[model samples]
Target: MTRPAHVLYVAWGFPPARGGGVYRALATSAAFADAGARVTVLTAAREAFERYTAVDAALEAHVHPEVSVRRLPFDWPAREPDRARWSAVRRAAPRVWWRVRKELDRVSFPEVGYGPWRRVLEAGARQVHADRAVDLVVATANPYVDLVAADVLHRDHGVPYVVDYRDAWQLDVFTGRRKHRRGSRVDRLEGRLMRDAREVWFVNEPIRAWHAEQHPAAAALMHVVANGYDPQFAPAPRLEAPDPARPLRFGYIGTMSRQVPLEAFRAGWAAAAARSAEVASATAHLWGHSSHYAVEHPGSSSIPVTPGTPGTPSALPTGGSGGGVVVHGPVSKTAVAEVYAQLDVLLLILGTGRYVTSGKVYEYLASALPVVSVHDPGNAATQVLVDYPLWFPARDLSAEAVATALVSAAAAARTADRATRQACADFALASSREAQLGQRVSALLDAAR
Candidate 1:
């Protein structure tokens, strides 16, 4: 009998770590296993997620039984002592110790929080390779330290590796700015990995194009592997329009990161109410962790904005003016479908950029709800949702433009028929993660041959 191709998958955020990139990481592992590869995943300990980032116990139920996950120690000395089991010194003065510890960690490895794990991960890869011949090593990055392990396995054991860059390491996606100086440690490391990698994968075309332009020699190896929505979270398409009498419910489910322009969204919602009767009664519900640390810790931070920025209306909600926008805290994955079912319009709020296509946008597409895009017109998501029939893009980031879009979207939500609903569902089905990753996995296997 012939042995199956052995794949060593490296990712820092896997199941239980409910971060945005977790879905991509989890799906990649399943795709490799589904393609008949013997897959093994190396990731940070579950405790690390519980102590720092929020955890989604629901995701564990979805992981394939064939895949083996190995967890290594990852102590986040930055976050305050939760129920985590760590040293008293680390628990007491995290702010003080983190600064000192982080500096030393960077000296050994270029990555900040994850740099110290370099030795353990490299050793883990070597150990996995020794147990059985590893035919391929696929590493996903945020820490980018995973590339070090991939490089080590390739150098020591002659295993070909792939770099799955969920996001760019040296390029800021939001601003299209260079994050590292030329010929820096990160620059040298990135160059080495790209040169050595068998393939380089990116989530979107713009990101791939940017990398290709930066490294012309490695451009041939670059491939676009988009992040598609998981079928489990999407509710059945709503064929009926929402009741005209009741207040329209606009929903957004994702992290409320610093990049999110909530002030503009709030301003727009208020403006829509003032301008249109159909929108006046509308309520926007934000359902997700405010920030990664918001759910687990106290004193969660928020971005402060000027009283009235251009395009931003001054009528504040309650604390400043009235009540309509509600911020619901994070919910479990099991409850995600129910949340979508309750909404009439989906608010697609995002940062401004040509390279920012968030994974949530795909899930929003799957919901089959009327979408009000509260973002810069130049965002990459506009490219994805251009053909989506239910989409109502804002003219600009200004409050008045967003308000107009919101009002239009509210009307669309109340008038959408069966045909419109089916079209949205069809759009989602076409970009299903199974279909997206299946093609990539098949291509990867063929390349390995």
Candidate 2:
């Protein structure tokens, strides 16, 4: 007659919020629900996603029916584009207004856009706890403000909390540099939070090590929980032998941020096409949003591509050398499998960073397709793919290096047998989302007992 452990999962980005971190949040919550925990999620309102970022309505279906989600109203004045709603000060002396706004926000918490949300989240957490006692609190961060709710509950009710850092609060993952000065509000706040946390989780060992170095006292509590592919969203491995007559399809998924080496990829694709007949006939598909936001504006970093006619590639400029490049825009999470199924090769083009390991890498591995990694060799993702049988990593981001990798990937696509594809898929089985979250969930629940 024992009741299920009540778990409070706080995340800034959830389903329909088309950010890169949304997938991990979705899968983590779902994993908790599947583990028989009474899961409740706190996230921003649907309007926030619809207005500020792009929304994927289809992803809503992925949420487990048993899990309850409560959306809180978020105030993000910085991202507000509607000038009509702005005050005179914001319209006239915008810089001064922003400076004042940031100062006011930091009065409550150290973060700018998210600091003001601390009180709102605390109130929400208190209200949730009042209804039914929360057994454990798990807070995922980017805005890092979500951690405040967990901290509030822990301080007020003696509840244990877990801080799940999707990225660092004080360290810039891309540059491996400290974002805040010593003794600053951010540093003090992060130190206090980590010191009080029951456990702190990071996406990779590098990030964990970095945080451990910063917080030696809490080093023993830190753990690595890598981002793994969700089985429901991953495409089945393409086991069929390649038909030389049909052109191969190379694809890239996830956000195309400003840091992504798109120009290098373009040049490399063209050069690879000129050198290899298989690559010459192949088409490259770019899926997902261009930049972090879906709303297109003038001078945006998004690559311009005409909407393609059915059964034809989009009119994307390839310098008149390579195979056609098509921009399919953002694909729905529900339709991920379908899009990935059509791709013969997965392109892992990432920004240069030793700590950058994208979630899409797991999906690419699961696809069992030949992967062409057009990123820095020093990237953390390279380590993950080093043992991958079908991975073709570029030596560098240069056009020649990328072209070489692309050509090799193309060759693999044409010649790789079903056994080789299966072996690659087998290698990825250990990295499934369920596999990654299962032990963690059990440990947390057991601790709650």
Candidate 3:
């Protein structure tokens, strides 16, 4: 009898670490385990998630029972807020201390906040391999230090590794610019990693093309594995037509980062309300974290938004003529379906960039609700929604354009029949998380044989 292929999955942000990339990591590991692979995940300790970012304890329950998780201690002195834990140098000459710390971190790896983690990750990967021979290594990156573990295993044991880049290491997706100069340390390191990788995965085609241009030798190995909605977590499409008498609900989910055009959305919402009675009566709901960090600080700008009761509006200022806007703070992953069920339309307000394709796009598509796109037309996300039946894309990021899209979406919400809603849901079926990961898992399993 043949045993299952053993796969080592290395990631820095596993569940309980509630970052945008966590869903992909969770789904990827789960996909492998579901495919009958013996999956072992290497990640940071639970304390690290609690200290650095927000935690979604509910998400841990979704992990496949067959998969095993190994945690490592992570050090992130830069984000430490407790002055009591600070060294004297950090308290006195903080800038100088940080400079020295960054230099020390780069001595092991090129990344600043994550470089020092390389040694620990390597040791952990080695120990895991020592216990049972690893058939393949799949490393997802952002701290990119996780890739070092896969590289270590490949070099030491002749194991093949896959680099799953949730985001680019050299290209800034927000600006579509090179983060590192040509022939710089990051450039050299990334080139080496990609060249040696058996397969390379990216979230979108634009990002994959950018990386391919940078590494022509490994172009054929690169693949675009777009982010998709998880069927287990996403709510079923609301086939019932919205009541004409009641006010419509427009919602936005995911992290509200500094780059998100919140001001534009406010202005647009107000304008839409003024122009259309349907929109004027509609309530806009914003869900998810105010920023990447759970706590607001000097370097971070967590919006001064108050959490509203699940079904009620908050007392906070709505910032525009429309009085129905509510900020509902972060929602747990387990409760996402409930949140979607309450809304009539989705607001896809994203930062401007040609390469930016948010994971929210897939979820919005899955909701089968009228979607108003309040982002740059040039954004890669536009391409994803171009063929979507219910998409109402703004021509530009201007307030007028956003208002126009919002008004159209509102009208759709009121008049859209069940067939139209079902068609929208059907369009999104191809983009489910299981569909996106299945082909890759099958290919990897075949190679393992």
Candidate 4:
């Protein structure tokens, strides 16, 4: 009898680390296991999430019982800094010392904060391979250092490795800017990994296209494996009519980082409120982490902001004007459906550019609420939402444009016809992660054969 293919999957932000990438990582691992591959997940210790980011114990339930999970110690001084435990030299010149330490770490291995983990990971991969043959090495990245371990296994043991880039390493997704200088360590290291990888998966075509251009020789190996919504997290498509007495509640549920145009959203929301009474009375409820960095500083509530322009609506508790933008902060994975059920409309806010596509868009699409997109028209997310019925995209980043979109979207939500609702439900059911990942995982496993 033939044994199952042994797969070693490396993802630093695996389960319990309630970041945006966790869902994608979890889904990928589960897919491999469901495909009957003997999968072992190599990830950072769960304790790291407790100290650095919010933890969702609920996500653990989704993992396939047959999958083996091995957690390694991670030293994230940047995330969980301990001044109390600092060395004399570190305390004396903290900034200088930190910079030097970073340089040293990068020199040893090409990743930050995660560079030192290379030796441990390399050792772990070798041991896993020694115990039983590893047919394929799949490495997903944010801490792209995980790729190094895959590369090590491929070079040493001849195991074919797949590199999965949920986000780019050398390119800034928001600005479409190159982050590294020519011939830099990142450029050299990433080039090496791409050239040797059996296949490389990107979350979108634009990103894959960019990488293809960067590494012409590896272009043929590049594939688009999009980040998609888990059907289980989807709230039943909103069928009820919008309440007329209370203002429409437009909600956003996702992490708010520098990439998210919160200020621009605030301006647009205020302008929309002033222009339309329906919008004026509407409340924009912002949920999820204000910023990933906010976890390090627990006392912080909202992102810092400049005062709103005069004549705009009054500032809300969250820094935005119109008293419409309300920040609810982070919620557990299970509470997501409850939050979605309360919303009359969903706001899809994403960073600008071809490289930027927020994972939250899938959830927004699944919710079936009228969506107001506060993002660049050039954004890759536009491709996904363009065909989606009930999607109202902003004309531009200006407050006037966003306001216009929001007002129009609110009107649509108040009177969404049955056809529009059915279309949304159909679209969501078709775009689920299971539908997306099922064939891709099978193809990948077949390739391993």
Highest lDDT: which candidate?
3
Clashes of each: 4, 0, 0, 0
lDDT, candidate 1, at 65: 83
**Residue 63 in model 3: shift from native, Å?**
0.7
Model 2, C-alpha of 380: deviation from truth (Å): 1.0
Q: How many backbone clashes does candidate 4 have?
A: 0
Clashing pairs in 4: none
**After superposition, candidate 3 runs with Cα above 4 Å error:** 298-307, 310-322
After TM-score superposition, the amount by which residue 13's alpha carbon in candidate 2 deviates from its true location, in angstroms, is 1.2
Give Cα-based local distance difference scores for all models. 0.81, 0.84, 0.87, 0.81
Give the higher-lDDT candidate: 2 or 4: 2
- Evaluate model 3: give its lDDT: 0.87
Positional deviation of 295 in candidate 3, in angstroms?
A: 1.8
lDDT by residue (tens digit), candidate 2, 188-221? 8888899999899998888899989988989998
| Best of the candidates, TM-score | 3
TM-score of each: 0.91, 0.95, 0.96, 0.93
Across 107-220, the per-residue lDDT of candidate 3 in tens digits comes to: 999998989998999999999999999999999999899999999999998899999999899898889889899999999889999999989999999999999999999999
How far does residue 132 in candidate 4 sit from its true spot (Å)? 2.0
How far off is residue 67 in model 2, in Å?
Answer: 0.5
Clashes of 1: 4
